[model samples]
Target: MFFKRPTKEVERERNQRLLEAVYSTKASWDHARETERAVYEANVNSELHYRSRIQEQKFLYLYKIARKFKVHGKLNDGVIDR
Candidate 1:
């Protein structure tokens, strides 16, 4: 038996629903991608800040040690600036 053809109104409603579903899926994907990119950038910035802080600490420690040795006259090799 042949199936009856759908009316124009029914066909239009179906097409509208399909288009809405497609647009919704695309919007969700776009939002997810943007969020991921933002998170990645924040992580990179945090890591760089951490490394710079560590480097500064190292320099300060070295400077303190060099000064202590210089005061004792035990660093005649002049490895660090007087």
Candidate 2:
């Protein structure tokens, strides 16, 4: 490609354009990183909520089973106590 020698004004304009482009790119990258961080935190919160619910359900199930065994007097090797 044939290239002409860059004049002072032309070089200044080109540098300005490059600087602006770099600034915009950096700003966009920063915004993207912030968005990603927010999404990650939300996902973590949701996962913890789900886990807590699952644990609560499991506790309730165990409680019901224990109550059933106690009422029927079927826990362990047992002589039926009326």
Candidate 3:
């Protein structure tokens, strides 16, 4: 049926959006973590301070991403959960 077909497509599209949003936000968080470690090791006082702020920003973004993912559907937040 035409309605059935459209419904499937709609679900598929919805899934794609949710997946993309989740993955992209996760990647951003990972990058931030990497930066945090790299900066911490650098031993540069000023940059380390900046990195602290960056780390906080990244965490805030990560929270938003998790909320977004939850809004779409209840997905496993493995690291965040632990």
Most accurate candidate by lDDT: 3
Compose the digit string of candidate 3's lDDT tens values, residues 1-82: 5555446677668667766666666566677667677777767567655655665675666567556645354556773764
Model 2, 3-80: lDDT tens digits are 878787876676555544444554555554555566775565465445445555554554464454342322334445
The TM-score of predicted model 2 comes to: 0.47
lDDT of 3: 0.63
lDDT of each: 0.53, 0.52, 0.63
Instruction: Provide the clashing-pair count of each candidate structure.
Output: 0, 0, 0
Model 2 spans with C-alpha error above 4 angstroms: 44-82
Ranking by TM-score: 2, 3, 1
The residue-level lDDT of candidate 1 at 15 comes to 57
* Model 3 / residue 44 / CA error / Å: 6.9
Please tell me which model should have the higher lDDT, number 1 or number 2.
1
Clashing pairs in 3: none
Where's the lowest-lDDT run of ten residues in candidate 2? 69-78
